[model samples]
Target: MESKAICLGFLPPRLGFSSPHLLSRSPGSSTFATRQKFDSRQTLLWNKPQLSRGRVVCSSSNSESKPETNHSSKSNYARAELFRGKSGSVSFNGLTHQLVEESKLVSAPFQEEKGSFLWVLAPVVLISSLILPQFFLSGAIEASFKNDTVAEIVTSFCFETVFYAGLAIFLSVTDRVQRPYLDFSSKRWGLITGLRGYLTSAFLTMGLKVVVPVFAVYMTWPALGIDALIAVLPFLVGCAVQRVFEARLERRGSSCWPIVPIVFEVYRLYQVTRAATFVQRLMFMMKDAATTAEITERGVALVGLVVTLQFLAVMCLWSFITFLMRLFPSRPVEMTSPLSELLNLDLSDTKKIIAEYIWIGGSGMDIRSKARTLPGPVSDPTKLPKWNYDGSSTDQAAGDDSEVILYPQAIFKDPFRKGNNILVMCDAYTPAGDPIPTNNRNKAVKIFDHPNVKAEEPWFGIEQEYTLLKKDVKWPLGWPLGGFPGPQGPYYCAVGADKAFGRDIVDAHYKACLYSGLSIGGANGEVMPGQWEFQISPTVGIGAGDQLWVARYILERITEICGVIVSFDPKPIQGDWNGAAAHTNFSTKSMRKDGGLDLIKEAIKKLEVKHKQHIAAYGEGNERRLTGKHETADINTFSWGVANRGASVRVGRDTEKEGKGYFEDRRPSSNMDPYLVTSMIAETTIL
Candidate 1:
């Protein structure tokens, strides 16, 4: 912003330097207004120590009019007049002018394709040589295990090797050839350049496979099993050789040779495809005219892919070699183990047995029968039982009514003797039977009606029990869903009545307790104390074969006369197919048993008793299903431990204003005959 008038003295005639042009500031105040190339030329006055006289003569008359500028009286006159308010003289030397020019100078740009060929071809040779050999080796090993003919195996190996090698080689060469076409001149798309670099480098890695394997073989030649050793130790040995080679190269000061960039070029090609594309061939040519030292973005992207491929190849090869070693076995694998000695097992021996033994089932990776142990976790017992071979042949007793029915032979078989019971229990269970009529055990009473009913005014009762500090707390009693304010609060007690007990007077004193706050006194507390516990206990450890058939038969016979049934202890006995004993449609001889009919009926009665007990615990006269209010059940009271002191409880609001509560008790009131008879409908639908 400082403007000083400079004195260049007076111009000589024909020296050809016009009045210096006015320097107008540019549009952006931050930078110089205008920039022009400096025109360097020598004026006659420049070489002379004396100023020009001709240009002064022409301005003599005009200068006389301004007498204040005529200060020739003193030797310091020129210096003083140079910076006068109206005018100033500018004195510039060659050195100062040159300095000004230098301040505005710039550097040259970057290049894209100078050494792309070398960058591409080297990796091509390397990656191809490496990947092809393994493919062949894998195929040959597989064929050998399959016991293919000698000539066939040899041919397969040769063809596989050649094919993979050719593919790798072509890919490498192609990447190298295409490197020039993909340039990194424009930084906008650096990805293309990088892919070219990666593809090139990967091709070079193929050489590692060849050289490393050869070096390993040479070093371990003195070993007893050098061939086998090389096969297993190729990757480690190759890496070791590569490290030593790299170190020597570094020492020789030739580590930055162009070979790396060439290999890197191939890798860049792959990255461009998977990642992004940058710089085209045309733009690269322009950049190439300048510096070739800058790393193209494309080069970086390609190198990433190449490095990944290298590491992946090493890991895969190592795993494969380990697998091969496992198949062949090592010496003295076991020293003093009795089991190993008894089995006389070695790695090779084990592999043979596994090949012969492993079998797949209907489910993928699921093993069946004895041979089905190889693929996965243990099979579900409910879906698959072990095969049993006992009693007469399946054909011999196929028609016997007092014998076990057998499934025909198969590749795999179920292994359970006849007459086994299978009991399955899903967690929460709703009990079947009447909720009211507390002590009523009507063998033929209607499920909806009660034989005896009590009439009394509805009264809410509190259940007093010792809590955490053994302090008596009044908990609301009954089925939570049907009770007042429901069982959704943070209290262990619920109030309501047992609907199954009867329809007359509302029952009271039912307690809604969460399962977690419970202290079950029996069965190691492994099972939740609920209707399901009693339902599943009968079949818990029993198997399916003859026992199951007899149990089914007894259940069918009981259903003809009774509404519900269960069995505690069942023992099979021979009986003829007659009248009530012959109720089942099954012709299996195992089902034609005596006394099983009576035992099954008794089991049903026991379950009914347990159901009644659960109902009573909820409360007597609590009209709630099980032991709560109305027809609703509070599952939260039992499912979660929200009722105990310091327990969590949650309640939801129904804005719809509907009278029906969301919670329904898990009792027959939810639906009578939920069990025993529910499966019958599903079975009929299936049939």
Candidate 2:
């Protein structure tokens, strides 16, 4: 931001450190951008320098540590007049200008070529990348394992693993903004420059460099190699993604397909696991080697060195690749310069933050959120400032007078933005400071605050089940359109891809909920294919509502990214398929005490009398799902029995036998409002 040009004075190399230094900085389109070749002319300016950390340390007898910016009065006059109000430092300007030109040449403007002659080489490259390393490493692995089958499997797995891991590394570069090479990348609708040369180089060299341990493992022991390989499997499965993805990008030049973006999600997941994989692989290998006990001192040293080297190698590779990107981006990566990263840096420095205020829409089933910057970090809800939104936009008010106030009730870590940022759970009120009609949390709050309700200390664990449907057709994810699968007999907690559909979305949602600080217990495939369930645990008071709503919101975000639809319609399909349920697990302080089975029994009696009233508030369209058949109690009746899924309220056999523990309320449908459901349970049983 300085206005004047700075004079360049040379510095002599420092003692002890004589290697050439790298001065990395972003330089393109922000000003005097250049696209001229970096061939040989500018290389002279960077021929000499010393490196330390950020500062360039130079040795001096009399002197020589001066930077290239101090000026003489005579030169200062010329610099001030000639390059005024523009960047003119020798290294920053010279390096960026040349790098930009080189990047353009390397990542040439893509041309859409269907079945282009270049693809014939892709297969050849892919095969060679996978086969050649295994072919060379096989002899060593064959000696260690002695079994030809295990040797071949281990050897080939190593090559493939390295290749897949490298895919993730390649993407890390492409997804970031580099200085001279790329400033901003405009995405093509369908066409893409898939991996370019890095696809081949990454497989051949990076696999050899960072994943060098793959070869060293064979000499140590048998299972050590396999387990170490397994540790990197997160990267393997997460990034093996790109092999198919790159092929598709090449094959479908300029053509659009929805699945590409979904598969690209692997990159995000892979990044999260990248740092952890090394540690996991180390533990696995150490455990395996120590058990075998055929280890020599040399093997011990080698194993330690290998793991350490590999860990350092991966870290260095990341730093080198990222630094290399900003400098000589010979290959243009299609990165959307996230301007937020600049602001994010400021956020980290200042500790000021973004708070995403989330509220339920007028439809009650819908969740809404908006973000605002706050002055600084805040923990207490009372300390956070109140904000407003246009109520008419969310159907909570008429346009004539539409502002709705958002009162912060709870705050959770913002999983998406991360750092010190937070996700605030809020409820709406009118400008006149009255709770809006759709503010169920407010009513739940009043009930929870009651002295009797507070004394009971209610806990609710809601099992929320929902079906995933194809975005376009609105049919269950794996079910045929206008048709059905054989039956739901084997789909309950099914393992195979055929029976368990949308596991990725489900898993993503589960992790997102946990990362957002929600009390998410666990998740599993449901009895119905394309359906899954996640539990919002043992949370107390109105927090049960707060967590479930946020968890649901997280699922909505993840499903949206996956281009899938989440159906909370109680029963998405007619007939024999099992319906989704919110299945509230309730317990009071008394119910968890010794000899509390009698107390639980008394609470069930209260629940049975108010079954109809609770059902109406449980969810919309409950009659469609609560039909006596399909693991559901009939809507018109209230029944209670031990371990009875079909009963309106089921007491666990353990609870009956141990004379303590929680009872399950089997009536609420998947679409039930947790605020209403949890509070009502307390109101009837304890209050």
Candidate 3:
């Protein structure tokens, strides 16, 4: 008998099979021997099989006779190979073909499971149905006080425990219909995918049940027959609206949907509590009831009943929603990856150049910039060529014909631009390139580089305070209109819905300062509501004013988008409220050395001599802010004390303890030009 090999090609590993194999066997016998050669797709034959049995035979040459079974297998494999093209090959076998067909069937349902619009519409309908009947019952109870408590308690019990809970049970049993609409997956906390959803739902339910009814009783004390519907309707409508909005956001895979509802609810709760307290006082003063003691007892009982019923209703609704969500989970959404914005280009061998020109003017009131495309960046910033501008436009010259040359002293990266842009801080000079005699930045730089103090290396830390005001009413951004907010007691560094506002602007300014390399120390909410403070520290030479001006410019630009005005007014708001101040903390190398406290006192004494001059440049409207009230010194006289805010200059207590450190000039109003103030301080204190 001649030896023969049966080559059986297997499917890919994805179809759960290994490589092709060759089985060697004698003619007309089932017994086989293995000859493993898995590298090539083409099979080789050692010998031809006998034509005695109806068995398949594969041949290497076309001259050999082909068998029916082998021919069918070859055709199927050829078709698969053609479908995959030249880069791919497929080996078809009886088992592999069946498995591939079954996989298609298995994945078909998942592909067809795209979310439907009905999921969003169904919840809106259900919530509306629940709230409509409450309005009628509330109205009926408001009309008749005799049956008010019983009506409210029964209405709440029926809606919450009976109807709402029954609906939840119905949805849970028939989850197939409701699951698709409610399915969601939490993106932030992967370990507990739906944990936030659960917690938030629970809180919303609690506020509706316990907080609202108790608040109702507290508000309508003597009458004890207030309309619960009117108070609760807004809450119900708001919840329904929020749910609809959240569903839309969820479909788009927004992480913010879960947080926003909670914030709104908490704020609503606070408003309700506040209103109830106010109403109680109003009722008491009016003497609305014959016996206040009797009304109070009945009010307590009614509140308890109302709370119990409302709790049951909210619990039922929450349960229904939770069950539907678990049955059909939402698919993860694909988000766009954040790419770093390039701010500089590598053009070392390129011919093009880009630069930005920045200058200070308006009596050092503003820092302005304009882009200029140049042949190349300045080879030496210290020797930058002077540029000219219309000095009259910037309030620096007497007439329009007069022009001023801008002398660039320092250069920095323009943090807000998204290219290789440079920020040039320049001082004003006469058209002939002579330094402008009255320019504050030039004066500050000259004083800083004076021979008497040039070697001391003076450093400054300026604490800048300002307020954000709404554009329309001109009131502080977060303050209540037509009245004040809780007397401004709880706003400083406070973290809550009521106490903090305009944090987004503050945060943006801080980041901009940091990116600009401004040496900004930190920021915090100030004593008065809507007043905020930021500090710049260890800024040496004239760089202190340079960085401060840049920082202020960034703040003003960021607030412009929101129609918010940044007010550097010393007393943005008058009365018992604290005024804003730019307290400048200064230290020299000698002032920080041993026995520096005496040197600090000596500087203070010199400051006393120039009190009138310092106050004059401290900023306009200083007298309104620096009165001997609200942590301010008497503006008429100069006084220095250790850690005393109510003084002209406050010497740090640590400086007194260590016998060395720095002193803060607290008399500078918030609106003072930092350049002018620092210049005077250096001229008076550097001995």
- TM-scores, one per candidate: 0.15, 0.54, 0.51
Name the regions of candidate 2 deviating beyond 4 angstroms.
1-346
Every model: Cα RMSD to truth? 39.4, 26.3, 33.2
lDDT of 2 at 514: 85
Among all windows of 10 consecutive residues in model 1, the one with the lowest summed lDDT is: 466-475
lDDT (Cα atoms) of all candidates against the true structure:
0.24, 0.62, 0.59
lDDT of 2: 0.62
lDDT of 1: 0.24
Ten contiguous residues minimizing lDDT sum, candidate 3:
77-86
Supply candidate 3's per-residue lDDT for 308: 38
What tens-digit string does per-residue lDDT give for candidate 3 at 1-687?
001122222222211112121111123333222122122233322221221111222222322332222212221100011110011122221111110111111111111222233334445544444555556655665465456345545554444433333333223222222221122234422212466776686677655555655565455544545444433443454455456555644554432344334433443453344334333443454456656666665556445535533454455456445534633363322121122224344555665455666777664556566666666656456756667777787777878566888777777666666344566777778866677755778777778889877788888999999988754224576654223567867999988867987898899989877877679999999999988999998788788988887788778778764456788878866567888899999999999999999999999999999899999999877898889888899999889899898999998889999999999999998878888998889889985
Give one digit per residue, the lDDT tens place, for model 1 in 643-664: 1211111111321122211111
Candidate 2 lDDT, 358-451, residue by residue in tens: 9988777877989999988888999999999999998999999999999999998887778889999999999899999999888989999999
Q: TM-score of model 2 relative to the true fold?
A: 0.54
For candidate 3, the per-residue lDDT at 419 reads 42
The TM-score of predicted model 3 comes to: 0.51
